[model samples]
Target chain A: MYGNAYIDPNEVNKTHSVLADEDPKLLAEFEARIERGEKIEPKDWMPKEYRKQLIRMIEQHGHSEIIGALPEGTWITRAPGFKRKLALMAKVQDEVGHAQLLYSAAETLGKSREAMINDLITGKSKYSNVFNYPAFTWADACIIAWLIDAGAIINQVANAKGSYGPYCRALDRICTEESFHLKYGHDNVVTLATGTPVQRKMVQEALNRWWPPIMHFFGPSDKISSHTEILMKWKVKMATNDDMRQQFLNMYVPKIWDLGLTVPDANLKKNETTGKWEYTEPDWDEFKRVINGGGPCNAERLAVRRNAEERGRWVREALKAGQTAYVVPFA
Target chain B: MNVAAIKELLYKVADDQLVIGHRNSEWTGLGPILEEDIAFSSMAQDKLGHAQGCYQILHDLGEANPDQIAFSRKADQFHNCQFVELPNGEYDFSLMRHFLYDHADQIRFEMFANSSFEPLAKLAKKVKGEIKYHVFHGNTWINKLSTANEVSKIRMQTALNESWNYALGIFEAGNFEAELKNEGIFEGENALQNKWLEVVCPLLEKAGLTIPEKSSWEPVLGGRKGYHLAHLEALVAEMSEVFQIDPTATW
Candidate 1:
C-alpha cells in the first residue's frame, strides 16, 4: 500500500521554469499530442521540463513502493495464522516487485536506479509521508492494506491514464495486483471490526492512529496547491488532491461505516450540494513537518533503507561486474 | 493402517515448514538485495502454503482446523526440527540453512511421491516439483557464496559448521517410524538421512566447503518428540501474539 505522490507545497512555490522559455514548435507538438491522448514513448521528443517533472514524479513513486513495504512487511511474521501469514508475504513481496517495476519505469526518463536510491537515502528525494509513521499493530497493517492501498489504486488508476508509456504500463500491472490487496486487507479489517470486542478495539485504535495520515495522504486541498495548468495539460498531474480525496471518501467511507467502525473525524461527511467531502482540515503543518523528516518513523525508515543499501552494496557491485549494457524494456 | 504414525509424520513435516517458512519471511525487507528479498518471500509463501496443505490433511483426519493447530499450539507441542527453529542471524546463516534444509525437503518429498498412501503420494508429486525449484535456488546461492570471496566463503563455512548438527536433527524419527516404514507409508528416517547426506555432501565439496567428520556428528534428537531448544518458545510466542488476542476471531 502506498500514499499519493506528495506535492510539497514548497515545490509549487518555485517559479514555473518551463513557461519562461522553450522551443515553441517542439512544445506545441508535445502538448498537442498529449491533448490527443497519445502516449509519450521513451524515445520521443519532450520538453526538458516535462522530463524533469516526470523523473521527479516516477522516482518518488518508485521510492514510495519499496519504502512502503517495511511497515507491512514487519507483520508478515506475526500475522496470526497460515493464511494471513502467506498472504502478507505475497502482498509485501508484490510491493517490492512494484518498486522494481517503477524503478525501471523511472529509469527510462534518464536517471539510474542507483542515483534515485542515493537521493532517497540522502533525503534529497521523498516518498509518501504515510510510511514515516509506524504500523503499531496487526490491525494497522490491515488498515494500510485496505484503505491506504485503496487510495493508491485511485491515484495509480488516474496516473495509468497518463502520457508516459512505461509508467502507464507499469501502473496497469500494479493496479491489477493492488486490486487483490484491497480485498485481502478489507477481509482482514472486516474480520477484526466485526469480531470479538478486543478485536474490534484493536482495529478501531489502529484506524484512529492511521486516519490522520490517511487524511494527509492525498496531499492538501487544491485550493491551496500550486498552479498546475501546464502539468495538467502535459497529462502529468491527473487530478486535484481534493478531488481524489472526495472520490475516496465517497467510495470507502460508507464501507468503513457499514463495518460499524467510526472514522475518528466527526465532520467527515459529504456535502451533498457540492458533491464533495467536508471535514476538519488536516493539519498541513504536521504534514509539512513529517514530509520534511520529523515524523515518528522517518529516521528509522531511512536508516533501515540506508543500511540495506550499504550492506547490499557488495552484491550489487558483484552483479554489475563485467555485466553488458542492454537496452531496457519500455513496455 | 497406522493412524498415529501418519499423524505424527504429518505434524513434524507441517511444523518444520511453518517454522522455516516464517524464518524465510523475516528476510523480506532486509535481504542483501531486493531480488533476494523477493526470492526468499516467494519460497516462504510456498513453504507456508505447503504447511497449510499438510494441516488440511490432518484436519480431515480428525485434528482441529488448520488455523487452531497452527496458531494455538505451544512450543512444546510443536514438532518442527531445531534447525528450522533457530533465528535467522544473517544472510549467510539463512542461506546456509536454506541450502541444507531444502535438500532434505526435496528428497523427503520425492520419496513421499511413491508412498503407499495414495493421497500423500499425490500431494507429494506436486510438492516435490515446488521443492525442486527451492533446492535449485538454494544450491545456486550456496555455490556462489561459498566460492565468491574469502569473506562470503568464510561466512558460509562458519554458518554450515554451526548449523551442521541441527540440520542432522531434521531426520529424527518419530516413535512409529519402523511401523510406518513397515507399512511403506514412510521409508524411515535413517534411509532419508543417508540420501540427504549423499546429495548435500558432494554439493558442499563442489562448493569448496568441508563437511564435519563423522565422529563429530551428533544429531540433535527429541524435536520429533516435542523437545526443542530455547529459541522455539520465543518464535512460537511471537508468531501467535496477534492470533492469541482473540482466537475465535475470524482474523
Candidate 2:
C-alpha cells in the first residue's frame, strides 16, 4: 500500500537548486529523450535538479511502503481465520517486498538504503500521510487494503509510464501485486458488508473514519508553478495531485456505493455534465499537521521503526563487518 | 485405522504449526532487515497452510471446521509445545528458534511421508517440500551470522542455550504415541527427537555454536496435555480476538 509522494509546496521556489545551472546542451538532450518516451537510466546524463527530485520521490515512495506495512501488518496476528490469516500475511509480506523493490530502485540513484532508512527513522524524510492515522479495527485494515491500495494503484499506474526506468519498472511489478491486494481487500470488505449487522456497522464506521484520509492520500491539489511544470515535463510527476484523486474517486466511489456503503462525504458523486467528482474539500490543515509529525500514530509509528533499527543494529554491524565493500544494487 | 490415535497425532502437529506460525507472523515488518521480514512472513504463511492441512484432516475425521477448531480453542486446549509459544525475544532468539524448530518439523514430516496413513502421508509429502526451503533459510542465516563476528557468535550461542530446553519440548510425548508407533500411522516422539538431534547437532557445530550439555536438558513438558505457558493464553486470545467477535459470522 502506498500514497502519492508528498512534494512540499514551499520548495517550489528554491531558485538556487533549480536546473538553470545544467549545461544547455545536456538539458535539451534529456528533455528530448523524455519527450521521445525514453527512460532515464541510472547512468544517464540528468540535470542536478532531476537527480535530486527523483531521489526524493523514489525514496519517499519506498519509505511509504515499509511504514505502510506497520499499520496493516499489525492485523496479521488477529486476522479472523486461516483464510484471512494466510491472506493477510501474504498481503503484508507483499508490502514489505514492495519496500525492498522501491529501495533497490532508489539505490540505483546513488543513495544507499541505509542512508535512506536513516533519513526515515530520523524524520528527515516523509512517507504517505495516510499511514499516520491508525487502523482502529479489522474493518479499518480492510479499508486500507481496498481503498488505500486502490488510491495507490491510481497513482502508480500513471507513474509507471514516467521517465525513470527503475521506478517505472518497479511500479509495473508493484501494480501487478497490488491488484491482488485490492481483490483481497475488496473480498474482505464484501464479506463484512454483506454479513451480519455487526459486521456491516464495523465496516461502515471504518469507512467513515478512513474517508478523509483517503481524500488526502494524493496530497493537496498541486499549485501551478515552474517546478511543478518542469517535473511534469520531465515525467517525474505523471499527474497532478487532484487528477489522481479524481481518478481514484471515479474508479472506486461507485464500487463503494455498490457494496451499499456510504461515502462520508454527502457531496461525493460523479457529475455527468462536467465529468468530475464533487466532494467536501479534504482537511488540508490536518494533512499538513499529520505529515509534519502530529497525526495520531506518527510518533508511535516512527518509534516502532526506530526500535526495530535499534534492536537490529548489532546484526547490521555484524553483517557489515564481514563485507569487503558496499555495492550499489543494480536497478 | 485407529482414528482416535491418528486424531491425537493430528491435533498436536496441527496445533504446533498454528502456534508457531502465529509467532512467526508477528515478525511482519519487524525483522532485522526487509528481506528477513518478508522471509519470516513467507514461512509464516507456509506454517499456517501446513496447520490448515492437518486441521483439514481432523475435520474429515468429524472434527469442527478449521476456523472453529483453531479459533475457538483455549490455551489449555491446545497441544502445541511451549517452545513455540515463547516470545520472540530478539532476532538471535527468533533465528535460533527457527533453526531448531524447523529442523524438527522437517524431520517429522519426512517420517510422516512414508506413513501407512495415506492422507497424512500425502499431505506430508507436499509439506515436506515447503519446509525444505524453510530449513534452508534457517541454515543459511545461522551459518552467516554465527560466523560473522564475536558479538554475533556470542548472541547466537546465548540464544541457542536459552532456547535449548524449550526446543526439546517440541517432542513431548502425547497419550497416543505408543499406539501411533505400533499402528504405523506414525513413529513415536522419542524417535522423532533422536532423529532431530542427529540432524541439528551437526549443523549447530558447523555454525560454531554450542549445544547445551545433556545433563542440563529438561524438556518443558505438559503442553502436549493441554498445558501451556501464560504466553500461549495471550497469544490465543489475540489470535482469536476477531474470530470470537461473531463466532457464527462468516468473517
- All models, DockQ values? 0.64, 0.90
Model 1 C-alpha lDDT per residue in residues A1-331, reported as the tens digit of each score: 5566766545644536645687779888988999999999999999877888888888889888889999998898799888888889999999998888888888998888889999999999999999999999999999999999999999999999999999999999999999999999999999999888988999999999999999899988787776776778899889888889988999999999999999999888888898888999999889989999999999999999998888777556545544689567465
DockQ category of candidate 2: high
True contacts kept of each: 0.67, 0.91
lDDT of 2 by residue, A202-276 (tens): 999999999999999988865532347778889999998889988898889889999999998878878899999
Tell me candidate 1's fraction of native contacts, as a decimal between 0 and 1: 0.67
| Chain B TM-score of candidate number 1 | 0.98
Give the per-residue lDDT of model 2 (tens digit) for B1-251: 99989998999999999998999999898889999999999899999999999999999999999999999988999989999999988999999999999999999999999999999999999999999999999999899899999999999999999999999999998788888888788888999999999989999999988899999999989888998889999999999999999999998
Alpha-carbon runs more than 4 Å astray in model 1: A9-15, A18-21, A321-330
In terms of lDDT, the poorest run of 10 residues in model 1 chain B is B144-153
- lDDT of residue A293 for candidate 1: 94
